[model samples]
Target: MKVNRFGRQAIVAGAAVATASMLLAGCTGTSSSPTASADPNATLVFGITADPTQTIPWTTTSEQSVQVLSQIYSPLLTTNKDDQPVANLADLPKVSSDGLTYTFTLKDGLKFSNGSALDSADVKYTYEKIMDPASKASSRSYLASVASIDTPSPTTVVVHLSKPDASFPSGLTAVNTGIVPSDVSVDSLQTTPVGSGPYKWAGRVANESISLERNPDFFGGKPGAAKVEFRIIPDDQSMVSALKTGSVDVAIFDNPVTAKTAVSNKTKSMEAASLQYHVLQLRAASPVLSNVNSRLAIQCAISRQDVIDTAALGSGTVTGPITSPEYRSDPKAQPCAKQDLKKAKEYMQKAGTPDGFTLNVMTSQGLYSTAVDEAQNVQAQLGKVGIKVNVQALDSNAYVQKWLAGDFDAAIAQNAGSADPNTMYARYFTSGGTYNKVAGYSSPELDKLFADGIATTDTAKRKTVYTQLSKELVDNAAWVWLFTPKEYIVLNSSVTGFEARYDADVSTLWKASLS
Candidate 1:
């Protein structure tokens, strides 16, 4: 959705630094010139699949990784073009005189793709469903602040919360907040969808492809690129090949490979600086990761710079865990490295396991080129400090399910999309925070600090709260933090009107033009 763009690892290069130079020199997406003149009838073809890797809203996270699910879905609110919090399903929300409640005014003429009115019921239903643990939304962090939602009327919806949730508005825009109609309490998501976005589902083509047609009455208005056909090519080489052969105009990827040969007439690309943060998630439920000393030892042993040099190719900045600058705004947010192998061993020994431990680490495949390699490097590096790591790789579909199940010791994943620091930090740090305790952590200090953050709308106060929380989260060694990559996009010079948004939704047809 925001600060949005992507690439992948396909071509092998000489070294980490060498590959990084390739990224620095060839990476695209941030257009050097303004978008071309708006061509209303322009049919801009992008490379993507109509078939979503996973249609399950709760678990189907990551903006660019899953393309259609984002466009066809609606969150409570979304980050608008200006990168400011704006209403998506709800009109700019107004807080009650009492800070505990909030009411949203619905857009009168809204309807889902299936021709159902987008009423307060849908809003209430969606929120409740997402809040339920069974829904298993990957961005379950979105509902952490929500206590409940009440439909006062068809057009007016009221939200009741345990506390004053200042970040509630921002959470609404998250992909995880996409509305669901049926009464689903941990049940499976509907195979067919009824979204309120600019595109409508035409049909699913096997497990690999899906098709979409533009909604003439899309809320923001119709997109210039009509009849979008999403062809899923799970292989990075295949995806890049599809784009290169002109079989598809746009495709989503997260490696530096596409940029390597972008000078040819495939299509221009965009490299967006994303708020999406990649982190090493240690299941708090796990025996080894559960121990603070073990976690600290693992954190110190990680070579974050290697991950950046090999994986992201020096394109993005090294940021601490939960590195969301737009929301956190912390001054001391530098990447941490727990050096002194002797000390890491000491932490392990103090945890009463001087011999260290062996664990499995799983990361989603085709998501990032460097994650697996980084995982390998991490395993080797950690071994020097006494930890043995086994790496497992899976596709996007299985990745979501396994991560939510907390089956692995460490899961390497991104924040997916939310740029709001409040949303990112609270989801993974607060007590019972959906993504927070993924590492199964319970820090009263972090909880108290995060609570104070969501209480006030004041920017300075919010920033201060977020800063303190981030520092503590990193210091505790809950997970190893890595670089926050700049969202990258590539495009042909003919394409125009592209701008990098912070909140993930980078494609807005209205703002685009063509030669």
Candidate 2:
């Protein structure tokens, strides 16, 4: 799933004063604790760049929403500090020898925030809802192989898969797969969610803040913080100011400049190497982009390093499709790692557009801090090879709707990577994938490689299969793969126990407290 980019500085610059006013208004009762001793009852104000569009766990692909939802909803499984799948709502599943069946037992005395008993029925219902086309879940593809689910008893859940999938267990650990009560209305869950997680949804002031209180019925005992408030601070500079003034105890910043500003203000910060990357997506179905040479030309013409340096202030590493260490493609192996205007021109000539061609690139203003900058940089770079790139900047909502509908010539996008290559790229590369249209291209060979990768449980064999798939994607110029930026979590000096995850998970806040 692609995580929406953060750091919308331009769009919210004028609203900074109004935003700060709202923050101050909301923080009247919740005081900061910069000099106080460790207090578990303190309200931990978390600053986020954007308001969550989707609060229903399975329906959203946004990282901002996932961060909040992860606290309100607990999945059957979750990842440990090492990124390995671990039990959450249920004990570790017992897999059959064939790897086609998994049996899970619900944790003893599990109960939702509403005081309703949670059992295997909720788990079964959650997975079924995700697989239902009506749900339009972003994670529907994750449970593609689930043939049927059987709840033999109140605590026992047996999942039967059509075929063997080595990554199946890990897929269940995604935040989107969080369990919801079997009887809960899907529509109501968006505003009023009920789960067995550490926190319960208290209230939300649209576009201003979201509040959560500790769940008394949580199976995981008591959460560290009594209350958690997620304040929507659209402007990065404003977030830095909030950190400096002790208005916000913790905030996540994707913009290196903003992060540096926060740190200079005496805030404690840690940088986590995230599995998130930015990409220039060429719609292969578009008239000009349909030609492989044209896509290849665009890929060869742009310098990823230049984009990183200018847009991200050199705070990222050039990356390929896969970000996981074991199966990642070597960036150096990419054809145009170093700009090749000569080769670019040759491809353009082969594309039957030797003189010049106009390319319309759509980007979101105030979505990602560097979105417009990156697009403009590509526009300038592509100009050297006869491509006239027109950069179109739109609001985040418009951009997301258009992008998801595959209504674009090209787009500048930020996407989330996964520990398993199959879990990351399968939905984009498979013929029947939910995002196949958005991806704009797929072939039998690519689909076969994806199938082969997940069919085996052997790590070495899976790595070899993914290596081939990665090459195929780059060789065909699936998307202009850019760099993965480091995500910074800035905290007040008094905040303790918060640890950053490689995936930029904020659920660790359940253990965080004010010192």
- Report backbone clashes per prediction: 59, 0
lDDT of 2 by residue, 1-515 (tens): 11223323333333442343233223211224556666767888998766777888887666678888988988898887667788888888999999999999888889999999999888888999999977777788899889999999999999999999888888888878999998889778877988878899999998789999999888877787899999988777788889999899988766655565676444677766677789999878889799999999999998999887666656678998898766787887777878899999999999999997999999875456677778888998999998999999887667777887889989998888878888888878889776788889899999899889889889899989988898898889989999997676778877777777775677667877876
> What residue pairs are clashing in model 2?
none
Each model's C-alpha lDDT? Answer: 0.64, 0.81
Stretches of model 2 off by over 4 angstroms after superposition: 1-36, 264-266
lDDT of 1 by residue, 89-132 (tens): 77788888667888888888877776767788987877776777
RMSD of 2: 6.1
Q: How displaced is residue 354 in candidate 1, in Å?
A: 3.6
Instruction: State every prediction's TM-score relative to the real structure.
Output: 0.85, 0.91
Please report the candidate that would top lDDT against the real structure.
Answer: 2
